[model samples]
Target: MDNLQRIDYLLHTNALDEMGKNELISILLDEYGSKIVRLAYIYVKDQGKAEDIAQEVFLKCYEKLDQYRQEASIETWLSKIAINICRDYLRSGWFKYFARGVIDTFPYLKHKETPELKLIEQMENEKLMQAVFSLPQKYREVIILHYYMEYSTKQIGDLLAIKSVSVRSRLARAREKLQKKLETGEGS
Candidate 1:
C-alpha cells in the first residue's frame, strides 16, 4: 500500500496512547529519519540543526497524527513541515550570527556502513561543497534533492509542491551556475 494509505489506516486503527505513539514514531522514524534530516540539511547546512529539525518534524507529526486529514502523502506532509522548519531556522538571527561558521558538520551517518567504505568513498571538494552551499534556497533544494538524494524531478516536485517542469528548470539553472562557479574556481 502507499504511504498515504498506510498512514490513514494507522491513524484510524491504532491506539493513540504512549505505546501506540511510540510504535508509530518508530515506524515513521525508520522510514523518514535520515531523509528528513538530509532535506533539512539542504537548507541549514548544519548537521546539528538538521538533526534537531528532523526530531522536531517527527515530534510534530506524532502530535498531529490524530488530526492529519490524509489529503496528501505522509512523506509529502513531512517534507513540507521539514522545509518550513528549515526556513525558520535559516531566517533566524541566531543562525546567521552564531551558526554560520558551524558548517564543518559531519555528513549523515549510515548505521550499516563499514568504516572501510566510509574512508574509501571520495568526498566532495571544499570548493564544490562551498559552491553548493552558497546557492539560493530553491536552487540548493533542487540540487540536493536531485543530485545528492537521487530524487527524480517529479519526486522533487511532489516533495516541494512545485511542478516537475519548474523543478527541471530550476535544476538546469542550478547546474549552469555550478558549472560556471567550478570553471572559475569560485562561487558565481
Candidate 2:
C-alpha cells in the first residue's frame, strides 16, 4: 500500500504498533518538513530554532496520534499542533534569543536582484512580513493564522480556543500595527 493508505489504516484501526507509528511519522516528516519548518521560522524568526520547534511538533503529534479524532483534515490537525507548539515556545521567553539583532541579520534584507521591479516587490514583501512578526503576540498570532495560513476568523478562534470576536479584535489590532509600521518605517 502507499504511504497515505498506511497512515489512514493506522489512524483508523488505532492499532499502530511502534514500528507502524515510526513509519507514519517518517512519511509525514518527509512530506511536510519544509512547510512545518517554514511556518515555525515565521513564528520564531530563527532558522535553527524553527527546525527544532518543527521536530518537537512532530514528536508531540506522534505521542498524541491516538487521540486524533479525525474531526478535521489531518493537515489541519497537524497545523493546529504546530501553531500551539509555536505559541508555547513564544510564551517560554526563547523568542528573545531570536529578537536580538534580527534586523541586522535578516537574510531577506540582503538580497539583490537585477530586475528593479522584482527587487522592490521582494523588499516590500520582506518589510510586510517583518512588520507582521513585530506585532504583539496576541495580534501576531491572529494575523499569521488569518493571512499566512488562510484560516477564517471562526477557524482561528476554534484553533486558538478564543471567541470569534476576540479573533476579530486581535486581527484588527494586528492590521493597525502593520499600518503603523508601514507608515513610520519602523518595526516594533
Candidate 3:
C-alpha cells in the first residue's frame, strides 16, 4: 500500500504502535524530507533553518494525522504544512534582523544515477540556485514552486492558500524579475 493508505489503515486499525509510527515516519521523511527543506528554503533562504522547518513540518503532520481530511494528496497536505511553517518563520522577528544570506541550497535528495552523473547534476543545480536565492521571497516562492518543485499553479494556490489567479500573476512577475536578474547579473 501507499504511504497514505498505510497511514490510514494504521489509524483505522488503532495500530499506531512504535513500529507503525517508525515505519510511517520513515516513509514520510524518505519521501518528502528534501522537498520540504527545499520548499522551506525558498522562503527562509537559510538551509539550516529550512531543515528545521522541514522537521517541524513532519512533527506537526504526525501530531495532526488524525485530523487529516484527505481533501488533498498526502504530499500536498505535507507541503501546505511546510509552507505555513516557513511563512511563519519568515514573518517572525528572528528572521527580520538575524536573517542570514543563503548558505546552501538544498541538494537533490533522490539518487537515481551514477556518481559521475550526480556530480554533474549537482554542478548544474548550483549555478541556477544562486540566481533563485537572490529573488524577493514573494517572487522566489512562486518561482520555486512552479519551476523547481513542478507544482501546477492551481496546486501552488491550494498549498499556499491563495487564489490560482494570484499564483499566475506572482509567477509572471517573478519570471520577469528573474530574467532581468539573469541578464543584468544583479537582483534588480
Candidate 4:
C-alpha cells in the first residue's frame, strides 16, 4: 500500500504500541514537516514561528489521529491544522507586539550563471512576496494556497471550508491587488 494508505490502516487498527505510534508520527513528520512549515510561514511570516506551528500541527495530528476521516489527503489535513495554528498566532497580542519588530524573509538559495542575474531574481522574488504579504488575510491565503502550494481552487475551497467560486473570486482580487502593488512598488 502507499504511505498514505498505510497511515490510514495503522491509524484505524488500534494495534500500535508506543514505539509503533512514534514511528508513525516520525514518518508523518518526515513526509510533511517542510510543507507544514512553509504553509505556516506564509501566514505568520517568520521561520521560527512557522517551525513551532509545524510542531503543534504534528502534536495535534498525533492527539487526534483517531478522528481523521480520510476524506482528504494527509497533507491537506496537516495543512489545515498548520493554518489554524498560524491564524491563532497571527491573532495573538504577543505576535502583534513582538512580530512587528522582526523582519525575517525566507532564505532562498540558488545558483545562477551570473551574480547580477541572481540579485535581480532575488529582488523580484522579494518584491512579489512583499506584495503578497500586504494583501488582506483572505486574499493572501487564497493566493498562497492556489499559487504557492499549487492547490486547485476546489482543494483550496475544501481546505478553507469555502466555495470554489469564492476561492476564484479571492484569487482574482488578490492578483489584481498584487499587480497594482507591484507596479506601484507599494509595500516594499
Candidate 5:
C-alpha cells in the first residue's frame, strides 16, 4: 500500500504504538511544521510563543490520532487541530499581553538593505504586515488563512470549523478593513 494508505490503516486499526506514533508525527511535522508555525505566528504575533503553540498542536494530534474519524482528509484534520490550538492560545491571558504589545509596536522592523529604494520597499512590506497584524482577530485570521496560506474559502472553512459562506463574508470584511487602513495610513 502507499504511505497515506499505511497511515490510514495504522490510524484506523489502533496499531500505532508510541514508536509508530512518533514516526507518524515526525512525518506530519516535517511536512506541515512551517505552515503551522506561520499560522500560529500570524495569530499570536510572537515567534517564540507561536512555535510553542504549534508544538502543542502536533502533540495533541499525535495523542489523538486514533480519534480521527476520516470524515476529512488528514491535512484537513491537522489544520483543524492547529486552528483550535491557535484559538485557545489567543484566548489566554498571555495572549492579551502579547497582543497589546504587538499593537502598540506600530511599524514592524524591516530587513536591512543597501539601496535606498530597496530599503523603502522593505519598509513598505513591514508596514503592510503590521497593518494586517493590527486587524481584529476574526478578520486577521481569515485574511491570513486565505492570503498568506493560500487556502481557498472552502478549505479555510473546513479548517476553521465554519461555513464557507462565513469564510467568504469574513474575507470580504477583512479586505474592506485592510483597504481602509491602507488608504488612511491608519496602521502605518
Candidate 6:
C-alpha cells in the first residue's frame, strides 16, 4: 500500500492509542505538509496564512479521525478540509480588510544548468503564476488542483463538493482563460 493508503488502513483497522495516532498524524504531516501549505497558498496567496490553514487542516484531521467514512482517500479528505478552511478564511472580514496579493514564495521549478536559462525560466514561471492567480477563484482552484496537484476530475469534484462534469467544464474554461491571459500578457 502507498503511504496514505497505509495510513488510512492503520487509522481504521488498528485501535491506535493517543501516541500512535499522534505518530500517524506526524507521518501525514511529513508526507503532505508542504503540499497542504502550497494548496492553501494557491488560495490565500499568503505564505503565513497558508501555513496557518495547513495547521488547521491537520488539527481538524486529528479531531475528526473517527468520522472519516473511507469512501475517499485520506489525502482527499484532508484536501476537502483544507479547502473548506481556505474558503472560510476567504470569507472572513479579517482577510478582506488585510488581504494583499503576495508573490508566491515557493520555488516550484527545477534549477537549470545555465544562469541565463534559469533566469529566463524564473521570469516565465512568475508570469505564468501571476496569470493563474489572476483567474477567478473557481477557475484558479480548478487549474491548481487539476494541473498542480494532479487530482482527477472525480476526485476534484469530491473535494470541491461538485460534480465531475462541473470540474471538467471548469478545467476547460480555466485553460482557455489561461491561454488568453498568457498570450496577451494580461497579468504581467
Cα-based lDDT for every prediction: 0.76, 0.76, 0.75, 0.79, 0.77, 0.82
Q: Worst lDDT window (10 residues) for model 2?
A: 111-120
Q: Estimate each model's TM-score.
A: 0.76, 0.74, 0.72, 0.82, 0.79, 0.81
User: What lDDT does candidate 1 reach at residue 186?
Assistant: 80
In lDDT terms, which candidate is top?
A: 6
lDDT of 5 by residue, 10-100 (tens): 6676678888898788877877787787777666556677789889989889888878888887777887887888788778887678666
Error of 5 at 32 (Å): 1.3
Candidate 5 achieves a global lDDT of: 0.77
Ranking according to TM-score, highest score first: 4, 6, 5, 1, 2, 3
Best by TM-score: 4
Which digits, one per residue and each the tens of the lDDT, describe model 6 over residues 137-181? 999999889877789999999999999999999999999999999
Off by over 4 Å in 6: 1-6, 101-124
Query: Which scores better on lDDT, 5 or 6?
Result: 6
lDDT of 3: 0.75
- Please provide, for model 2 over 30-118, each residue's C-alpha lDDT reduced to its tens digit, 9 standing for 90 to 100: 86777787677667665677789889989988999888889876666777788888888877754556555464587564343324325
Q: Which ten residues in a row have the lowest lDDT in candidate 1?
A: 111-120
- Residue 31: error of model 6 in Å? 1.6
**Over 4 Å off in model 5, which ranges?**
1-9, 12-14, 98-124
